[model samples]
Target: MSHLVLLSGWGCDARIWQSLDGHWPTGVAVSAPDWPGYGARPPLDEPGDLAALAEAMSAALPTDAVWVGWSLGGLLAGALLDHLPAPRALVMLGMGPRFCHPQGVTEAELAAFRGAFRRDADATRAHFLRWQLGGEPAPRTAHRRLLDLLGRESPAATATLATGLDWLASLDVSRVLADPPCPVWRLAGEHDPLLAPEERARADIRLAEAGHCPMLSRPEAVAATLADIAQRPEHSLLEATP
Candidate 1:
């Protein structure tokens, strides 16, 4: 049985994976660890450093498991390519090799967010939540569900939130795509505002009528896709000559 590890994006805790948890295949074992400073997890010693953060996370992950990451989580997973004991496979959702894109969040926008966060963490978080849900088909419903999930956990620390913003402003993992440690699969929502058209085209699978956070708007579909990926023969991509 392949172990599946789900990593949530910035501003979100492990609770974000709750919907996906209930829908995973019966035999598959799933683990979703909260990132430092989120939920009950403690902040990293060096909060703003992505590499250090990835290293910390790698130390806690199972030796061999398929790593599935969403948004910022995807960037961190890619950063872990050489850090962790090789993952069985890697999957990215609603993100590409780099977070910054012509059609996605720009550096200036990120800076503005950082400023807002510095001034009022609660207001910034609330604004961010609304912005994220704006692209969903059912914005009100999606927003409510996300808020409800987040309400269960303590708000993420200000330092961690700033670190996440710093990551968005500078981190890029485009080079890692050249020779991934394992088979790599990409999933994206057809209407994800955060993903540019070119990025969406790169997806191995795309969810129709879904936005950035598909696990919330299309949990069953995401679960089925994950199950299928988990069942594929290990290194099938490596074996197949392109």
Candidate 2:
């Protein structure tokens, strides 16, 4: 049985995967570790450094586990390719080779968003949450549940959020995708605002009517997809290319 590690996106903690636990297939060991400065994890010694953050995350993860990452977490997972032991598989959701794409949020927009966060973290976080849920099929319900989860978990630090934004503005894993160390699979929501239609077409699996946070809006579907992948023959699970 493959160990599955679910990695949440920016502004979210391990609690984001709460709904997925009971949904995964029995006998599959799973873990959702919070990134530094999120949940109970301490802030990184060198904030704003992707390599350093990836190293910290690698240390916490199991040596042999399939890594599934969403949004910013996807980028971090890609960055881990050279830092950690090769995983059984790597899955990316709602993110492409780069965070800033012509059809997605641009660098300038990200910088502006960072500025807004700096000016008022609370208000900016609220706005960010709402913006993310805007494309979901059930925006109201999804937003409410996400808000409730945020209330129960420790919010990411302002400095950590800034560093994440910085990474979004500059990190690109296109080269890494060109030759991944382990089998890679891409999953995306059909209505994900962060990914363009063209990009979504490249995914191995697509969830209908879902947005960036499919794990929230379509937890069962996400769980099923992961289970399916886990059951597939190793030769059939090939590395994804940009």
- Best model number under lDDT: 2
Q: Flag regions of model 2 displaced more than 4 Å.
A: 152-154, 239-242
Q: What's the lDDT of the predicted structure labeled candidate 2?
A: 0.81
Off by over 4 Å in 1: 152-154, 237-242
> Worst ten-residue run, lDDT, model 1?
233-242
RMSD of 2: 1.7
- Candidate 1 per-residue lDDT, tens place, 145-218, comes to 98888873436887888888778777787777777767788889998988888899878889998989988899
Evaluate model 2: give its TM-score.
0.93
Candidate 1 achieves a global lDDT of 0.81
Residue 82 lDDT (model 2): 72
RMSD of candidates 1 onward, in order: 2.1, 1.7
Residue 12 in candidate 2 has what lDDT? 82
TM-score of each: 0.92, 0.93
